[model samples]
Target: MEIKGLRKIEPYVAGSQPTGKNIIKLNTNENAYGPSLAVHQTLASFDAHQLRKYSTLDQAVLRQALSEQLGVPANQVIIGNGSDDILSMAFLAFFNSAEEVLFPDLTYGFYKVWADLYHIPFREVPLSSSFEIDSQDYLVENGGIVLTNPNAPTGIYKPLDQIEEIVKA
Candidate 1:
């Protein structure tokens, strides 16, 4: 049986994993320094007995802490396993085939994949000459916009006022 939205979907090419000891693996999509000391401490203190059951669905404690730190309501937070899971959920929840989603031509790369998977059409607006995301590029009519703040690869960021302009447009 043919899957819907399967046609024209190019397989995602992941970064290369070169195997070797003493080799500096630079292609990783993760932080150069692995988990922090805080993460290690949390893992060490975790209750092994809790492994027998599912984690709490609400993550109340984590959400409360994050809410306090971010000064936002706990209800505004929605934690997930990782960014991929969160992005997948956002794509499925917010976008549809009716109109195209807008994103940068050079970005996290997963945006296109997520759009395709959800059967949502997407348009890629090219960055400026210096590989900077001009907020004006996203002002066109569209269903929704997705972008990486402090854009990847180039690491250029748009100022808050420019971002506000994009949002208002």
Candidate 2:
């Protein structure tokens, strides 16, 4: 039965997970090697009892540490579950305008999904013949821009100066 006023949309289809021995999965950004010794030690020493309680939303301590390491102010640091969570939050916070958001024609598929989910207009600017972002393309009027350095699938990294040019445009 079709429900009234249902928002039907195409969901993001992640890359297939192949199972096998001695296989490294890069599609999902799975670590080629297992976690380092520090991670193992941390997990082993983790207090399972703490799981019963919810974690603090502010994450002040972790944010402060990250800010110190990155040489940024604590207020500028944002810690989330993962890049997906951070990106989702960013989409919600930004990209509210009549102008269309601009991103590469080939990029993480989630960008389109987020835009669709939020009802934000977007345009997928085609990459150069060499599969690199043409900063000139982004110079046009846009609500916002999302450029993934060391882009996914293609693994092409646009130079920092070019990115700055686009930002300053």
What TM-score, computed on C-alpha atoms, does each candidate reach? Answer: 0.83, 0.92
Candidate with the greatest lDDT versus the true structure: 2
User: What lDDT does each candidate get?
Assistant: 0.85, 0.91
Give the runs in model 2 whose Cα sits over 4 Å from its true position: 1-3
C-alpha positional error of residue 60 in candidate 1 after TM-score superposition, expressed in Å: 2.1
lDDT of 2 by residue, 1-169 (tens): 6689886668999878889987888787679888999999999999999999988899999999999999999999998989888999999999889999999999999999989988889999999999988888999999999999988768998899998999999
| Each model's backbone clash number | 0, 0
